[model samples]
Target: MTTPVLNTVLVRCSHTYQDELTVGDTKLLLDTTFRPEWHRKISAEVVAVPRKLNTRHTAYRGLKLGEIKAGDTIYFHYFGLTKENRLDTEDQDLYAIPYHEIFCKVREGVISALNGWALVEPVEVKSGSAWIGTDSEKISTQEGILRFIGHPKTDQPALNVQAGDRVVFSKNADFINTIEDKDYFIMQQEDLLATQPQKANEIESDYAGPRHYYETSPFYLSPDHD
Candidate 1:
């Protein structure tokens, strides 16, 4: 019998032959044989966010429909696009939207997005546990990317984090470049400094900037005065 692995986070790997598959004999084969069956297994819901407009700040209209369950992992595939091959000028500019902001649905481990971006099931971590176990032999980091070492104990409340929280960590550039199949990393809770909160209002009201700037900026107001 095959041994069952618990707490394994699975991410759908990005594909490479997107352009080739869309044209010539490959396209003919896929249309007749593969496309019909593939469409049956997957469904896609397009998000209605604005593309290009004359504005300095990008406005996020948000995902109006669909939902991602607790155990969903987001997969991002970045392809720097230009007008010569695929994207138009306006379409290319729309790509500036961050990957995390884009949302989609994947059902039963089947990916729905043919554009190479999809969300996989998230890995559930047990409550009160700081360390995430990984199957890798070593951890690596790229230059200019910050990596933190988490405290073994939770004595410091600063590093305390909840399970299923999205975290930002510095990744090993060399290792990532060398290994095409590897996914996920092991890290202590303390090593991570920031977590993406579920809501904007959940952010704490602490200021770490200069007092003068905090007092003068129009965005900031003193709570004590009010």
Candidate 2:
């Protein structure tokens, strides 16, 4: 295998899923298995690294992934899934991705947000069926409960808020990921506007009213297909 150079890191993608295929004239329906969005592979093992840095690649100097070493399992961006980035070989599923595209190391048994990124669990409301941001046009009140906080990096500084803090972040942030069928957003720590520690009484829970005792919240969808 050829070593990547000039801040380009080589990696073999973990695994992604698709249920349908179109070849020639047939539309094939594959397995009916429903894999949650998190199960979709986004982390990959670093196969090779550049020997020398490029003068123009400032991001390669102090990488958030820290040294961008080989054998590191890191989460990266989609890179638009361009054919130019992928090598369609007979056996190798290799991708030559720029070092900047690699986000952070895959924290074992946990989700790790690195380089000033925060993993946020959207505050559930309306009987725990709807999300806080889903209905509110008001950005001030929109909030998320932090699940994991990233470590400080060279250019990416750590957030003042810790895990479990309720935070209202700026509208400039946008990125939502589904883990175990639940939604979480990964936004830059600098985007946070205000923060507060989680309170017991103010703890977000399934909203319950007298009517909820007899019926489900309108946002709910039963596992049974209707």
Candidate 3:
């Protein structure tokens, strides 16, 4: 019998924030501002595809089955620009090379580049699925992912996302697990806070009322002006 090709693949995304912030003040802030009804409306625009049944046969085997195809964009939500004071002694051995040694090598200019090997303190991982195909393709057993963050509501235009445009989202977290090898969570487009061009802008523009605001102040402002 031929191996059944599953419609969805598992992905591992790094945790974006520290545990202290997520559980303490950060979570509180998100709980206060997040409006479920508004987010649901945003998610409705993106068509949901039927997910294949979770079975032993469908579990992630390797890269051929895991490679992200065109139209699919993995939304990585992790803590950015925060100090991690927690001492992670238990998972020290999980590193192939000691953290100190890697730091030394990098400082000495011995290692020029570090990709996934570089560790983020208090790292949390999550995964989700998005179907890029239309009704016909969804019905068929096609394999692919779409690369676009949905357009935000009129009030949230600071998200500044245009349809078919790739974006990076940033926001604080609630609670994140420190034990899971890979943290996985199914995410919808509505969960996004702010978005900017995934890649560098090809064209330059001087007008900057609020095309893409990174600060929380600008984020809360009305997008109607710009």
Best by TM-score: 2
Query: How do all the candidates rank in terms of TM-score, highest first?
Result: 2, 3, 1
The C-alpha RMSD of each candidate to the native structure, in angstroms, is 22.1, 8.3, 19.3
Error of 2 at 189 (Å): 2.3
- lDDT, candidate 3, 140-223, per-residue tens: 321111122222222233333443343332222211211122211112334443433433322212212211122356445343
| TM-scores for candidates 1 onward, in order | 0.17, 0.62, 0.17
Query: How many backbone overlaps does candidate 1 show?
Result: 6
**Prediction 2 TM-score vs. true:** 0.62
TM-score quality measure for candidate 1: 0.17
Query: Which lDDT value does model 2 have at 157?
Result: 49
The stretch of ten residues in a row with the least summed lDDT in candidate 1 is 173-182
* lDDT-better candidate, 1 vs 2: 2
For all candidates, the clash counts are: 6, 0, 13
* Model 1 agreement with the true structure over 1-226: per-residue lDDT tens digits: 1111221111222232222232222332223233332222111122222232222333222212223332343323223121222323332322222322322334465433211121111122222444222112322311112122222222234344433455544342121110012222323233344555443322212212122222466865455445
RMSD of 3: 19.3
Better of 1 and 2 by TM-score: 2
The better candidate by lDDT, 1 or 3, is 1
Instruction: Give residue 151's lDDT in candidate 3 (0 to 100).
Output: 26
